[model samples]
Target: MSNVTSNSPSASNAVKPLDQGEEAVVRALHRVIHALPRAMDAELLREQGLPLVEYLTLMNLSETPGRRLRMNELAATCGMSLSGMTRVVQKLEAQGFVQRIRCEQDGRGWNAVLTDSGLARLEQAWPTNLAATRKYFLDHLAGLDLEKLAAAMRKIAT
Candidate 1:
């Protein structure tokens, strides 16, 4: 009664030769993971007036020896260009959150230091940020799944 051909395993299917279900699953996983950082960044920016990139830079400096890191090193750690990092540092400096100083070992190089204000801001944001991460990401995955995902990501990243 129907014109459509029945191409079960008995007959050769004319459609796609291979199933793309795995690719679809991979893409969905990628999207969910990618959306997380963007959402967290938006929340922090809206509530604290600190962009994620700026916060990451400040946090990195805060954890470093003397709460200072060379400008280039900070840029690399934050995955930003030197000029982009300079602009962010300028904004942080304006807000009294950070300061740029000459590197003690190399006068030609500059360092970005996280100020008390910067540390305080990070402190204020950290709990909520971490909670959001736990609620959205960690709480959903089993320990084994987390471990597997981490291993898979590390393999891909390398």
Candidate 2:
């Protein structure tokens, strides 16, 4: 047995190179991580006239209470830096999909609120997103235990 556990910090820094089987797993994961997003983004842009990041930003706002969240919180939810998220939100605002408003609870902060137009666009775009998600991600996982897969991904992410 390898002196390594999948969950072990020591395994990550171990002196030995990964054996062939282990190397193959890592290689496959690397390929999927990079390929899936690009493929999905392309599909989204082709079918929905919406980039993935924009779609995700709208979706995140739509789900929040009052259809709003603090700007920094929205940035975190979208896995973006504040400045990067600011740029995306500004574009959305320009398109009339969202608006930035001073936070009512705290005048110092800002919130990004989904506009009615954004909700309508999200409604129109949902089917395309669902189909792409299934085609690019779910369909490939046939017969695998999804909950287990999610747990494994969570472990790796952390």
Candidate 3:
């Protein structure tokens, strides 16, 4: 989804390679994109028994007005497939951390509702998540212009 385009001088139109600086940035960004989540996930799982995806799902639901979101909406918000979100919700439900009910506006759709237990669990894991985020990601940005970095990231995301 990046706006990057192939720049080929040859008739065959093969894509040109990134310059050294661009390649370095791309590789580092890609590694951080993956490694950060795995590091945080491992920490959370070890310390709090909650996977990063489940925490994100619960956190997203908690932020909604009624602490609930339609399954598809939650999936989008969490950047997960519908089936993946369903499985995470099922696990959370089995743990008594969430409840699934028919959506009021459309009974055919299900909503994931964060329960009291879920909130407690999130709160319990919040510190660990925060610590891991700081350790694996934030601390590395010590003197950088965060606003600019955030803007760049937003641009890439869009």
Give the winner by TM-score. Answer: 3
Q: Pick by lDDT: which candidate is best?
A: 3
Question: Tens digit of lDDT per residue, candidate 3, span 1-158?
Answer: 23356455662476566787888888898898999999999999999989999999999999999999999999999999999999999999999999999988968999999999999999999999999989999999999999999999999989
Which candidate order results from sorting by lDDT in descending order? Answer: 3, 2, 1
The parts of candidate 2 lying over 4 Å away from their true place are 1-17
TM-score of each: 0.77, 0.86, 0.89
lDDT of 3 at 136: 93
Error of 2 at 149 (Å): 0.6
| Residue 41 CA displacement from its true place in model 2, Å | 0.9
Model 3 gets an lDDT of 0.93
- What is the TM-score of candidate 1? 0.77
- Over 5-91, each residue of candidate 1 has an lDDT whose tens digit, in order, gives 565775465554323775676677789878987877887777777678887887898899999999999999998999999999999
lDDT per prediction?
0.83, 0.92, 0.93
lDDT of 1: 0.83
Evaluate residue 114 in candidate 1 and report its C-alpha lDDT on the 0 to 100 scale: 94
* Full-model lDDT, candidate 2: 0.92
CA displacement after TM-score superposition, residue 144 of candidate 3 (Å): 0.5
Alpha-carbon deviation at 100 in model 3, angstroms: 0.3
